[model samples]
Target: MSVQEHRRLRELASMHFQSRCLHEACERGLFSELERSPGSAEELARRLHLHPQACRMLLDALTALALLQEREGLYSNAPIASRYLIEGTATDQGEMIAMYRRSMERWEKLAEALHCGHTPAPPSEPDPRFIHAMHCTASVHAPLVVEAVPRNNARRLLDLGGGPGTYSIRFLLTWPEAEARMLDLEPVVSIAQEYAEIAGVNERFEAVAGDYLESELGDGYDLVLLSNILHCNAPEGCQRLLKRAFACLRPGGRVVIHEFLRDGSLWPAVFALHMLLSTPGGDTYSESTLKGWLHEAGFGEPVVSRLEGTPSSVLVAARS
Candidate 1:
């Protein structure tokens, strides 16, 4: 390799430095505190209860990364950070950043997974912030996705493994007469229920706290949504889940899958690595692979769509 190419390899390896720095900034609420008031590093350290020297270094690093701005030694949120890193704002994604931080430990196990097929150890306790972090990520795209899916004048819907139930809430809003049943882990289902109540659609939403794959999901649904869940299973498991989805729908009912298609993109390709680190045999699949699974599960020809502003795509098909 040329001298410059060798240097680039080291740079690529060290890219995790920037990710760790950003994760720490989010964990410390740096952007939100800075948004409240621009302050010198010393003032920020005191207000945020950080070690003085370390805080100064972190603030300067964030400034270098353009997530924060430093003017005359007073640090404040950069515009991008102001818009998406502040807590409680409409587009605040600080929680999502935290979610990435939480995954750092799992990511570290990639070498083990590669050599020994090791899965990262699960968290000792369920994370309460995870569902909220997912909400932050989903809220932006839910409206677009829900609007794109034809409501089909149907009344019953099932959201399998629907985290935070943002899609279900949006579905209910789009189809005013529709009722939704969202199944997920107990804690996650509770958050979904809370979100549905907040959306004023709880009257039409039911929360089922159980395993999406094994739960006795009642039949006769007009729609079944498998959003972001397929990638957690191996092909065989996904086939089973798809068959389950097929059986739950009424005749002529539709099933919609929302996921990142491994379509020669850098994002889903890297995300597949994360799945390897975390799941037993999970990985993102291509669109053709997904269509084959749908067909094998007894669905008709599928229609594929990539959400205009997001990394996710949808596959829609109906039980014949």
Candidate 2:
């Protein structure tokens, strides 16, 4: 192989080594401990009940990855790691990392899924860790999505597939008079309720538990949000859901869809692979394709807006 091609192949081959190193570090609470206080590998190993050599190697790998900093023999979390990876922080992403770690097993079977032409079935009971991970993610994205949505006289909202109802809570916060109904899987609804209560909007928010495709989403909503929901469904399923959203809205009401558009971004493209491994037909869709689906679902002309501070964008369509 050419030198350049050989180097690229080597990089790809060793990608999993870094992934495992980070995953193992997060799994072992290394970041959290380091956030509390810097320590030598020996001390950390004693505290965490790990071998000193293994702990040192892991800490050195994290330092190389820029997630941690080592001074002499003491290690501490880097600023980025302290902000996001450390548990109990306001912006903690530890749950999301754990969720990714949990999914690694399913992702390992990608070749088998390709050969069998089907992804594995979802667990009957939803994993609470996954729900918490989604909650953490939604908390970060809710403000961007709320900002992208057009402010109007929207008093009622239906948050379809709302994981922890973060978007709904944000919207309610933006419009004090607004009330929201969040529809999602049964297990997720409880999480949503907890978040809504924490946000002090539980009285204004209602949690409805059931599959959006099979559930009865009540009618006459001024707005409907399909945030990050389409990527979990096939194109046809997304179209059907849009139609349902259309039927649920009041006349001239709007439906807002938040998703990672296939707009030549590396993140969305890589996220598409995550969908391939996790869902049967779920994948990121192009903006033009989603617009076409919205049109076919009887919505009027759609306006697309890129969200600030995220790789996602929103498409707004009105029921005419």
Highest-scoring model, TM-score: 2
Candidate 1 global CA lDDT score:
0.89
User: Candidate 1 lDDT, tens digit per residue, 146-219?
Assistant: 86688778799999988899999999988888999999887787889898998999999998888877889989
Tens digits of lDDT, candidate 2, 1-320: 89999999998989878988888988888899988889999999999999999999989999999999999998998999988988777688888888887888888887987798667776667677887888788888888888887788899999998887889999998889999999987888888899899899999999998888878888999999999889988888899999999999999999999999998898789888788888768899999999899989899998888877688998999999
Which residue pairs overlap in candidate 2's backbone?
none
lDDT of each: 0.89, 0.89
In candidate 2, residue 138 scores what lDDT? Answer: 86
Off by over 4 Å in 2: 1-6
- What TM-score would candidate 1 get against the native? 0.93
